[model samples]
Target: MANPGGGTVCNGKLHNHKKQSNGLQSRNCTKNGIVKEAQQNGKTHFYDKLIVESFEEAPLHVMVFTYMGYGIGTLFGYLRDFLRNWGIEKCNAAVERKEQRDFVPLYQDFENFYTRNLYMRIRDNWNRPICSAPGPLFDVMERVSDDYNWTFRFTGRVIKDVINMGSYNFLGLAAKYDESMRTIKDVLEVYGTGVSSTRHEMGTLDKHKELEDLVAKFLNVEAAMVFGMGFATNSMNIPALVGKGCLILSDELNHTSLVLGARLSGATIRIFKHNNTQSLEKLLRDAVIYGQPRTRRAWKKILILVEGVYSMEGSIVHLPQIIALKKKYKAYLYMDEAHSIGAVGPTGRGVTEFFGLDPHEVDVLMGTFTKSFGAAGGYIAGRKVREGPLVSV
Candidate 1:
């Protein structure tokens, strides 16, 4: 449904304006939401009159100013690009050597322009250097930029007692003093870093099998496979599950890793509105009615990709509704619990536990230990028949 001010009226709630990852602000509502606090002059402020159960639209003027700010930044970027091209301003972009003039440029000029004139001005807020454990409170290393944020150097100063809100340390297990820290030290001494090979070869350790068993037991699934990294877990596995004749109904706001995986799968990818069961069901219905594109035949398989918790929006998935729809449509459900596992639910088992649904209802459950366990790696759990193929990926 449409909103009064050119936004989507999501679930009857008018969400506060939030800066998207691309630096553009969006006004989409968050599910199972929380009121966001606004800071003013280094002081935190709250809207005491607003009801917590209902979200209010950001002030019209605030939205206006937000766009205006971006517009101004874009205009300046264009002007800077013009100046640099005209040789009025010094060019900081990478120069092509005379011998390699025929070679394609490594980075696009427009990308460098946006980076220099737009992102660089606000880059300090991201990729900050921290000198302490990413617990509730940590230490940040202060640095200074002299060349208009083009390059930065250490100021030899540390900002102490900083509250951590950026990291995915949802369980506070990343603390240096946690009991797991001692266990990690002991394991590190014995393991000596990594296995230095792929799991398909000599890299498979008894501890790896033990961890996979623990993960399967944790999710109450038949079996599980662990991967070295969270991003690769999704990006590399989806292609193994489905291809050419398959259709993937993915949530619009799914992580980049999921997006990459779907693209790599050689499947027909269709996007459904984020966290909306109605939108998802509509897509599933259309897929069934229309069948595969061009061929006018039934798809080999249909995979539905969703996240347990949308990391950027802090929105929880409607797991029960989605499960019902997937079953009705006879589609496969692949739920990524990267940010939800060991962080939400009665026992922190994830959305399935939170909604009191059987884990098997979700065909493939993917999650990362990086967030909730404060550990590295990710896992995919399901029936042994379903997960068996992913080993080849």
Candidate 2:
């Protein structure tokens, strides 16, 4: 739901201020004569204020509101078999290479349709077709080059005339373009093209630290972590953060990698209707109402996950609003800006820069370097630190 506040910090617990005559639970934060209400659904409430302080120490207290501890340990996968089965069926339904066919049977009788009936309808034999040659089209780029020509030597080869476009270079860091080519070449000449062993064995190089430092400085975060591709960063971190009794809140359209990671974490998965903040709040409120009857392990830590820019829609996430919800509900927030950096924001600083949020404002920031930076690989920027190199040998 839209934030009703005119832009100010709103604080309060989730409360239905109309008086709990229905035996349903609710809490409204009231301070200085201002009140924030929790709708009857009891999902989430909009605080009139931004959270200047995070209640990291009071996770259990927040769980108290979720009295069966409804969502304490909910994970993402296989929780609802109907959904999982449906997804599996859909995935399996894809036409396999062997069974799929694109050829259409040729119809001899249809030959009359193309040449006789259709061609005759538009035939004009005597009329002269207009063909006037136009002079070479040119652009007026003032003071750009010494030759003042619109293009380089006209390159028109039958096999190689057009610009090469099929390079899998995402970060624009291809050897054909980036200066890193020469730097890497020199390094390879001195250190050899390949490291003989894993990082622990002997693959370690000073260049690794140099690249890591650059990433750390660019992100301006406390620590930066890198990992092997295809293995996925979510799998590496999610399981470690939540353990057995944790809940992962996934948007309806979250990428499959995250869905899989959350499942593998062995945590309970509770899906909030996609981008429905109100629904998320209701689920959390339900958790609070349910958790009140339990203690400790009965409750689950909550984490909200979303993408900074959805690939299908090219729509950007509203980070400020999401941050607000996280504060009121006391949930951790994780955002994947894989498609956002170097493309959306004015200065191309990714979602945070687009929204003007502080780096520490988000719990974790993840993005790939393929698009805007025009290179390969991805990066994870967060406050958490781990000893030794993050990549596996």
Candidate 3:
């Protein structure tokens, strides 16, 4: 079938027509034809003049159209109910097909199982694409199709301008800020790209030293070491700080990186209820009294790990209470401020400044530049600057 825009809908595929430069001609091609043509031509161009019309009915598109029909005084509640039932039936059929070799067993293939069982439920369900620059408000393409699977043919159709509600521009210093962009551009022009190697292996730029000094001055710490990755900062450093005979008391709701780091450290790890000083104290007391399992000897070292702000919970950590407990238990404190560092406090100095506490109170301070700083990588701040790889006793 042909739409008003000279586009064709054939066998659950979109056939787009383009006016070739040779003449006033409309060449209709299916999805596969378009892909093959692009491969032959080495590049493909999108014609703004050619308007596409009808598309296949994907589940999300169907629901959207059904809802719109209801809003416009049509009885679509029954249709919505029917679609839900259909989806449930499809799910049930997939689950019951034990002999189907195409579908991997849940135990054998975890990712594929999740894709089939969970992801498919809402796959191609929504199209909130940003067509223009990522600002406070931008253009979103609203399109629906039956054959529009997430893993298959998904296209941007029916563009509409809307305000962005979901974004990681925590401090409003992203693309919207001109000064930051200009500064970044200037730096990019001068520096080209990355340093290309780890700092130990001749990757240390003068800019690196300046940044570390600035971070230390800002955090009111003696020294700071920056890493290329925020996640790796925690993952790699935790193991260096504590090991075998040492004990690690971690917040139950700590970030995945911290959990992984603690696990790799080979430390006797005990979890405390998130943000609960009482629970933390109990765990500390028990660890101090019991020590290692079977041996009951004193731990070589005790490390208390927590976050300045819980990213998932949106709750601030009880730093004062935790600090008191750490002091009482004689445990080193490691605070991850990935979300809090540049997003909290009047001057954006992080949780330490927010809580009116000294930065030195926390043994190790960790944060990332991906959020408020609008940069990449992470940093680890501490009392003294150490050369080579960090080694904690």
Best by TM-score: 1
On TM-score, who's better, 1 or 3? 1
What residue pairs clash in candidate 3, if any at all?
A: 56-145, 56-146, 57-145, 57-146, 58-145, 58-146
Per-residue alpha-carbon lDDT of candidate 1 for residues 1-393, written as tens digits (9 for 90 to 100): 322222222342333333344443443322244333343333222211122223467999999999999999999889988898799999776778899988998877666666778888888888789998898898999999887877899989999999877888888888767567888899989997899999989999988999999999988998999999999999999999899998999999999999999999999999999877678877888899999988789888899999998888778887655665676678899999999999888789998777656687888999998998988999999888753333321
Report the lDDT tens digits of candidate 3 across residue range 104-208: 655543335445444444554443566765567777766554632433433656456677776556776665758768887999899978977888898999888
State each model's CA lDDT, in order.
0.79, 0.56, 0.71
Question: For residues 1-393, could you state the per-residue lDDT of candidate 2 as single tens digits?
Answer: 223322232222222224455676556656433355555664444433222332245577676866434342222222433453467523211232544344553444334333332333233321112222111221221222122222223323222122333323334444343466677678879988667686567766887667666766676667666544422766666676665666777877877767787888887788877556566777776665565235534355777888888765555665666676676566777787777766666566677666555665667777766556554566677665533222121
User: How close is every model to the real structure, measured as TM-score?
Assistant: 0.82, 0.54, 0.67
lDDT of 2 at 200: 67
List, in order, the clash count of every candidate structure.
Answer: 0, 47, 6
